[model samples]
Target: MGLYDRYLALRVRTTDAAVPEHVALVITERDLLEQGAYDTLRDFFAWAFEYGATDVTVYVSVLDRAAAPTLARELEDLDAPREVAVRQPDDVERADAPITVGIGLGGRSEFTAAIRDLATAVDDGDLDPDDVDETAIEDRLVFPNDPDLVIKTGAERLSDFMIWQSVYSELYFTDVNWRDFRERDYLRAIREYQDRNRRFGE
Candidate 1:
């Protein structure tokens, strides 16, 4: 670690506030196409775990569906700190790894798929329409784990990620692009999250 990185880490460690256990990052497919993007991702995972995050979810939004396979392959091959499970938009199974990379899976499509599954269960007499609750919907979600904090780089908008799960998560938006993202950026997000008084919608 560099001197500035060490200083940032020290600040985070000394903070009395709680660190987010589950962290989510929202980036675009174009972001990964940039140079050093994969290296940044590797460092990001290490930094998150070092700071207190146990689970890290990465949502890669792709404008073209044709690019999904290529993006998934590249992300899956990334040298990360933990196991990575890369899934496409239509994937029904839940990701079981510590790090999950969703390629071209928008939050709206994920929710729609979950609803469709719930409807199927209802139609098959397996689940009553009235009995279907939040738990049922969550059970059908591909990535059901809720994150404590969500980070979005290069923009303030959440690129259609974790709609159901990130309902109560603290969001941190940075103008820095993914390739330019450094340890300091991660620490800044952590510090921002730590300083927030999370109400979880009261």
Candidate 2:
């Protein structure tokens, strides 16, 4: 860690505010095309875990549906510090790992799919419509764990990302692009998170 990074880490460690246990990153599919982008991802995982985060989620929003399969294959082979579970739009299996990657899978699509499943069950007399609740919806989603902090790089826009789960998450947007992201940038996000008073949608 650099001198300033160490300082920020110390501040985070000494602050009364809680460190984010689960950190989520929102990036675009084009961001990955940049050189050294994958290295940044591996380093990002290390940084998140070093700063007291146990789980991390990377949402690689895709504009072209055709890119999903190639992106998924690359992410599955990432040299991450922990085990990773990669999920795309059509994947019904839930991705529950220390590191979960979502490629081309928008929250709206996932939510709608879950709702459609429940509707089908109700129609078949397998599940009652009145019994459906938050847990039921979450259980059907690909990645169910809600993030404590969500960081969006390059721009402030966070389209189609965790619509239901991130309702109460603290958001941090940085202008630095994915290729230029560094440890200090991540530490700054953590510092900012610790400095805030989260209301959890109060």
Candidate 3:
């Protein structure tokens, strides 16, 4: 660790506020195409875990459906700190690993699919329409873990990810692109998150 990185880590460790346990990152497929993108991701996981994050979720937006398979394969093969679960757009199965990656799965499509599943259950007499609620919707989500903090690099806008889960997450946006992201950037995000007085929309 460099001196500045050590300083940022010290700040995060000494903060009065609680650090985020679950962290989410938003990036595009183009970002991963850049040189050393996977190395950046590996470092990100290391930083997250080092600073008290227990779970990490990465949402990679893809404009082309044909690229989904290749992206998934690459992400799954990343030499990360922990086990990774990579899910495609049509994959509804829950990802239970410490690190989860979602490729090409927009939030709108996920919500639509959840609603479709709810409707099917209602029609089949397995669940009543009146019983359907937030839990019902969440149960049908692919990556259902709600993050305490969400980080978006290179843009202020979220890349249509974890709409249902991130309703109360503290968001951190940085102009730094994915390829240039460093451990200091990750620590800065942790420090920012630690400084916030999280009021879950209250």
Q: TM-score for every candidate vs. truth?
A: 0.96, 0.97, 0.97
Clashes of each: 0, 0, 0
Q: 23 in model 1: Cα distance from truth in Å?
A: 0.6
In candidate 1, stretches whose alpha carbon ends up further than 4 angstroms from where it belongs are: none
Sort the candidates on lDDT, descending order: 2, 3, 1
Better of 1 and 3 by lDDT: 3
Worst 10 residues of 3 by lDDT: 8-17
Root-mean-square deviation of candidate 2: 1.0
lDDT (C-alpha, whole model) for all candidates: 0.90, 0.93, 0.91
Looking at model 3, residue 110 earns an lDDT score of: 84
TM-score of 1: 0.96
Tens-place lDDT per residue, model 3, 1-202, is: 8999888888889868799999999999999999999989998999889889899999999899889999998988889899999999788787899999999888888889999999999999999889999999999988888999999999999968889899999999999999999989988888888878889999
lDDT of 2 at 183: 94
User: Candidate 1: which pairs clash?
Assistant: none
Write model 2 residue lDDT over 1-202, tens digit each, in one string: 7888889889988988899999999999999999999999999999999989999999999889899999988888988999999998888688889999999889999899989998998999999889999988998988899999999999998899989989999999999999999999999999899889999989
- State which candidate has the highest lDDT: 2
Stretches of model 3 off by over 4 angstroms after superposition: none
Query: Which tens-of-lDDT digit does each residue in 1-202 have in candidate 1?
Result: 7898788789899989999999999999899889888989999999999999999999988889899988888888888999999999688688888999898888899999999999899999999889999999988888979999999999899868889999999999999989899889999999899889999999
